[model samples]
Each structure stands twice: as C-alpha cells, then as structure tokens.
Target: MELNQIYNNAREKMKGYCKVCPFCDGKACRGEVPGMGGAGTGSAFQANIEAWQRYKLEMRTIHQVQNPSTELELFGVKLTTPIIKAPVTGSSYNMGGSLSEEEYADIVVEGSKEFGTIAMTGDGADPTMYNSGLEAIKQADGFGIAIIKPRSQKEIIKRIKEAEKVGALAVGVDIDGAGLITMALKGQPVGPKSKEEIEELVNSTDLPFILKGIMTLDEARIAAEAGVDAIVVSNHGGRVLDSTPGTADVLAEIVSEVGGRIKILVDGGIRSGVDVLKALALGANGVLVARPLIIGVFGGEKEGFKMILEKMTTELKKAMILTGCESLGAVKGNILRKLND
Candidate 1:
C-alpha cells in the first residue's frame, strides 16, 4: 500500500488518540496526553521541529564522490543507517488499543532487523509492556535494545538482568520518564537519579548501558562521568515537560562537552532523512525516528515500518551526496549554515 493509504488506515484505527497528521507535528494534537501530542503548552514539541528547520544546508555538487555510505556501527552492531526506531510504548491507552504492546514491539524489532538496523523497545507502567519487548528481542535473537523507565533502583536492576538474559545488544533507562504521571498513576513511581545512583546503575549492567533523555551539557557530562555507554539527547518528545528547548537546539552544546566521551543519539521532531543529515552535521552519532515509525507500524505493520526506514535511509544518502559527504563520518557542522552565519 502507498504511504498515504497506510496513514489513512492508521488514522482510522487510532481514532481519537491520534489524527495521524500529514506532518506529524504537534499542531493538530497539542496538549494531547493520551495521543501523539506534546505535553502542556506543546511548545517543547513544536520547538523540536522549529529548531531543525532553522538551519539550512549548503549543497556542493562539484565532487567526485560517486557513492555515499550511510553505514553506522553502534555498540558493536553494524547498521546500514545511523537511524534507529525510538523506544515507544502506550499501544493500549495512548494508541487506542488497536495494536497490543507485544504486537507493536514485534513489528519494530523484526522490521528494524530486516532493514539492517536495530529497534529500541520501551518500558511502561505495566510490567507486560516491558516483558513483551523482551520477548520480541528474544525472537530477534537479541538484536534489540530495551529502554527501561526510571523506576526504583531495584526495579531498574531487575529489568537490566532481564535484558541481559534476552541477549539484548544494549539496555538503558529513559531518565526523562521520571516526570511521567502515568507511572505514578499505575503505582510504579519514577524520579530523577543522583549521580551516585546513575553510576551504580551503570555498574550493574555488563552490557552497554545507555542513558536516554539527557538535554543539557551538565547532565551529559554527568552521564559520561557515570560511565554510560551512550546517551540519547532527547526532550522525551516534549511529553514530559512544557517549554523545554528542543533536542536540536541543545545538541551542539551537549556534543561539544561530551562528544568523544559518549555516543550521542538524538531524537524529537526528526521527520525526514534531511533532518537526519542535519542531526549528524550537528554531531549526533545517530538519530531516532519516533512518531513516523509509529505511523508506519500502526498503518502497515512490519512492511510499513521497513518502508519508512528505507525511504529515510535513501534520502539521507542523497543528502550526503549533494552535500559532498562521502560517508557519515564526513558530515560536520560546517555543512549547516545558521541564519546569522
């Protein structure tokens, strides 16, 4: 089916929760908690899109680079593209219950593997949400990453052990989930961690341990000092707080402070392969595509998801070629021209 058809199908299935807007921006669904909108004023969500749009690319066609490589290696796993499907849950309530948690995780894990990249599964207030992702990872022979919520220390450690058992490539905690009221509503409390607490958690996992949702250079440094294998510079898709700066707005500063020390992945309002190029130029090792994949999976299942990834990868390759980047390593901040510059 065409992408538009898939989107229509998803909109029909998801109904009130998500309108499945064409742009997937926060405009139509602002303040939509149970659906795909941002939190509070939705400014944070909008900021993500605006921040990326603020920068323009400088094209250079006078190059002999015939082929541009989009290959990326993360945590010892080789991926065709430096893009990973972000860990997302809430298929039940937030997504209108059209797709079960397990079904969604299965599509993402299998689809990502088929596309030569890995998917990150998410944790939710419900225990089954995480378990389903683990099962999917097991089915994928542990080619997935399971991101846990910032639960109690005991709970986080318990999930880490489970992730190891499933042979997950890496595991992490989206510390930004600490502000999610749904966790408390479900009786699973979550909160920010002290540096000591973060260090202890990192030490508990033998596998690569990532810390997601870091938006500030200070926190990025703390994560690096705490020995996290990587960090996802995210604003929790603007779902956790209002008026927070977009991930792109603060990514350069964070990367400057902790770039070589930690693998930096970014997400939030990344809708296209061109956006992915912008992210790489700004020093992100990888980018996460969230809402678009949600549309893909909900609309067309595994094939739908794969189609979106492949399209984005193709677009990224084209962007690289036009910008004289022969490989992902060659993409630099110079490729982007700020308005003032």
Candidate 2:
C-alpha cells in the first residue's frame, strides 16, 4: 500500500476517536501545547501523503512542472534534496524495540545513499546505540552523519571524535533537546546544562559542527558568529518546548539573520513539499524530518523510507516547478504569502 494510505489506515485504527490527535495526546490539538499542531500528518508516512497532494495542486507553475532540483550543498557535501531525516533517539521508547540504533542506521544509510544524501544516526551517546552507529557506518560505507546527544562535555567531545574517526561528514550537536518540558514537569532530569559545554565541544571538533535547537535570531546570529557550520532551527519535534513557535514561523527570522554566515536548516512541523517550499522561501538552506522516519520504520523499513524519499523529492520538484523555480537557489522569499499579507 501507499505511504499515505498506510498513515490514514493507522489514524483510523486509533481507538476512542477523540477529536484530539493521539500524536499530540490533546496538547497540540487544543493549542495548549501551541506549536505542536501541523507536525506532518502526525508521522512521516502521512506527511508524504499531504506533500503529494500539495505537489499536485502546486505543480501548475513552470517551476513545479519542471520539478526544481532539491539538491543542497552543505559545507562541502552535496545532497540530492534539502529534506534530511532528523535524528531521533529513544526508538525503544516506542515500538517495543523494533528499531535498534544499528538497524535504524542501516536502513537510513541504504536509503540515503540511494537518494544521494546523508542519513543522521540517532545515537544520543548511548553505548549500545553508539556501538550500533559504528557498525552501521562501516556497513553503509559512511553515507550519513552521526548525531550525538551528549550527556556531558567529555561525552560530547568523545562522540565528536568518534564520528570524525569514523569519517562522518559532520557531527550534529543536538543541544535543543535539553529542555524537555514534559520531563521537567514530571520532575525528571533534563539534558545537559549551559551552552558553554556545547561551545567547548565545537572547539574540540575539527569536523564541521551543526547546532540544533536554535529558535531566535539572536541564537542563530550567536551560533553563526561563534563559528558553527550550520544552525538547525528546531524545537526537538515539540518534545522539548511546550509552547514554542513552529520552526516555520521562525525560519525567516533565523535564516535572514544567519543566511550569509552559516547554513540554516529548519525542522518541526514540516510535512510536505509546500512546507519545504515555505522554508526555502523563508530562507532555510534545508529541512529536517523526524516522526516521518518513525512511520517509515514502522510501515516498510528501508524500502519504505526510500519510497518516502522518492515521493517527497517528486513533490518538492513539483512545487518548485509550480513556483517557477528551476533550482534550490531560485526558491525565493517572495513565494511565501503570510497570513497578514
């Protein structure tokens, strides 16, 4: 079955039929969680369906029909598309351990290589998961990035060194996940403290550094000025901040502030080609995806992920054609029509 149909089928399969989406568990649906809504059909598969539908509608323009190339150049690596699978940890938290870190990286590596981009391994520095990433890196021939959610300054440095030793193109420091409100509200421990530790890690690494969880222009500017290779404007899939603005809402601000200085990637609530278009228009260099990867893992594994990539790439190309854009560079700010406008 198609990815979208699978998502719809899953959604229909949910019990209780509450107006509130299970994805948000009532927070995002009611706006109590604020920017929690619009997180891509609640998973990757559904987001692909939504993107496909939007692509059909938006492909009337020359850019959309031509299907503009979604390729991106980050630091020195060239990618086939701007859509990246954001690294998500704690897969065992859901799915009863269906996706071990190694198996997940293997699938991501296969799909990313086939699609011509980098898949980020969601190790989060767990010894078991980190070991899995090492194996997957060798198996996939290192076609992806190793994202480390560090628990300490020393661990952060160690993770970056390991990634570099494995020849990873880059090491993403997921500092944005530091403030998970649910965990905090529950009196559970949160992530590490202070950007100083992160700054130290960046200094420790020779490889290009990507700082995720940047929200405001100040943070973007600061990271750029601090010499980060890329700034990922994200809120950790709304799993961290409770009422933060959607990454899209802040993309322009962050992009405009840091565009010439660093590569700006946006995540959170992006589910379609149109969403990607909006991000590019708002000035993002690329988009990162999370829950969709989960859906792909659940529904079809590696091949399922490859199909998701193809469909999203096709939809992005269609959107580009409709917008009269022939290349990623041509997706300008004028294409986005704000609510106030």
Candidate 3:
C-alpha cells in the first residue's frame, strides 16, 4: 500500500492512547491554563498547539514542490533526513500497556532501514531493557542508533560500556531523569541534578553524549563547555516539567550559545515534518518524535512506525523546497520568520 494510505489506516485504527493528543484531549487537558491546579503545568501544552498551527501554515506553502529531498548528517552519521524518532519511557510500563523489547526494537530497526536514517531508542540503563536492546541490536542491519538512559553515574558508565560493546553509533544522557523524583504525577518521575553531577556523568564515557531534557541556554552552554558531544534541547516532551518553555522558543538561543561546539538536537511536541523544519531553521541539528511513533507502533508495529517516518520526511522535503533550501545546511536560521505583534 502507499505511504499515505498506511498513515491514514493507522490514523483511523489508532484508538485509546494512540489517538493524537493535540486533537483529542488537547482542549480539556490543556496545560498553561491559567488556573490548572498542577505543578509544572499550564501554557507549555498551548505552545505545542501553536507550534503545530505554524507548522501547518508553513507546510501548505511548501507542499507542491518536486524532489523534496530530506537528507542530512547527524553526529557523523549520514542520514536521509535530520528527522529522528524520540525516546519514550513507560511505553508498556508507564502507559498501562505492554510491548516486548524485541517488538519495540524491531519497529525502530525496520523503520530506520526504510527511512535511511538512524532511529533513537529511549530505554534507560535498566538491565532488562538493555538486554532487550542488545537482542535488537544484533538483529538490526545498520539502520538505527541507541541512546540508553542511566539512573546514576555508575549505571551510565555501565550502559555506555554496553552500547560501545554493541557498537552503537551515539550516546545520550537523560539528565531530565538525573536526580529528583516526586510522586505528584501519575506517570514516571523526573530526576533533577546539579551541573557538577551531570558533568561527572558526561565525563564517565568516551562515547558521544547528548544531554536530554535541556530547557535552558545556560545548561546547553554548560553541556558544550564540558565537552559533551550533543545537547537535546528538550522538556522531556512536556512529560517531565509541565510548564517549561517550548524547545522552539529557546532553540535559537541555545544554538547560538553552544556556538557549534557540539551537535544540537531538540524534542518535545514534535508531530510533523514541518515541525522538524521549524526546529532546523531555528538552529537545531535535528528533531525527535516519540509519542507519534508510539501511536504508529500501537497501530501497526514496524509498518506503522515506517509510515510515520515517511510522512515526516516527505513533509520536511516539502518545507525545504518552499524555503529555497536544497540541502540541510541551506535550511539555516534565516528560514525562520517569526510572527511579531
């Protein structure tokens, strides 16, 4: 079947939590609401809505061009596009569902194979998850990347060693889960840590490390200064800290502050290819999508995931064409046209 047909099929069949959050529950479950009685809540969710709207406008302007190429390189890995799958936790655990490690890994490997880019795995340093990842790594045909999250410095060291042993291409540290956890939410807990502690974790491994859940330029600069390989300017997809600024809002500042010293990646409420384009134009090396892939995964496993990747790359190529960008490098900060009141 054609890619769009597959996407629509998946979209049609997608139910339960697999439904689009922005469309279904975005109105009532809205964050940034003036009187929402929750911590880290309010407005951040609204930013996602705004981002999606802007994305639609931009994609409409660019969709009809021929040969919309979506090729880019990330962390020395040549990719057909800068778009990537974001890492999501509690998929079966925190989400009241169940997907075996092999099943999850297969979708990633297969999708990456189909898309000609690397897929990002979100399993942290848990022994069971790592073992599952190892099995998938063995079956994979050089079409993906793994970013294992460790709870502690020791776990980080062990996970990095394992990833190295598996010959994984890149490494990412989820500082978003670094230190403090509160039982105030229904989902997984976010661990907050100090720069010193995080620096120690980064220095623990020789692999290219990306500090995920970075929402501030100051933290991004710290990651760069510490010789980390990358920084995922993210808010844990708005799952961790509720009211954190959208990655797009602060992406340019982080990109400018980091000063090309290291690769920069951004994630959080990224649902489409145009979203990826906006991120790239605002100074991100690439963008990550997690929940959308989860929806795809729940809908049709590898096929569903592959459809999502195809959709984003297609739309991203459309954006590139209209923006007059022939290559990833051509889609620079100047492509961004901010709306001013």
Candidate closest to the true structure, highest TM-score: 1
- Report the lDDT tens digits of candidate 1 across residue range 131-208: 999999999999999999998899999999999999999999999999986787788889999999999999998899
lDDT of 1 at 273: 97
User: What TM-score would each prediction reach against the true structure?
Assistant: 0.98, 0.81, 0.82
Worst 10 residues of 2 by lDDT: 30-39
* lDDT tens per residue, model 2, 167-274: 777887777757544334434343854556657777888888888888887777778767788888876765544455566666777776778888888777666667
lDDT by residue (282-312, candidate 3, tens digit) is 7788888776676677566787777778887
Our model 2 lands, by Cα RMSD against the true structure, at: 5.5
> How many backbone clashes are present in model 2?
13
All models, RMSD in angstroms:
1.0, 5.5, 4.6
What ranking emerges by lDDT with the best candidate at the front? 1, 2, 3
Model 3 regions more than 4 Å off: 1-16, 21-25, 28-42, 51-68, 94-98, 124-127, 141-143, 179-190
Q: Candidate 2: where are CA atoms >4 Å away?
A: 4-67, 181-196
Most lDDT-accurate candidate: 1
For model 2 the TM-score comes to 0.81
Model 1 clash pairs?
A: none
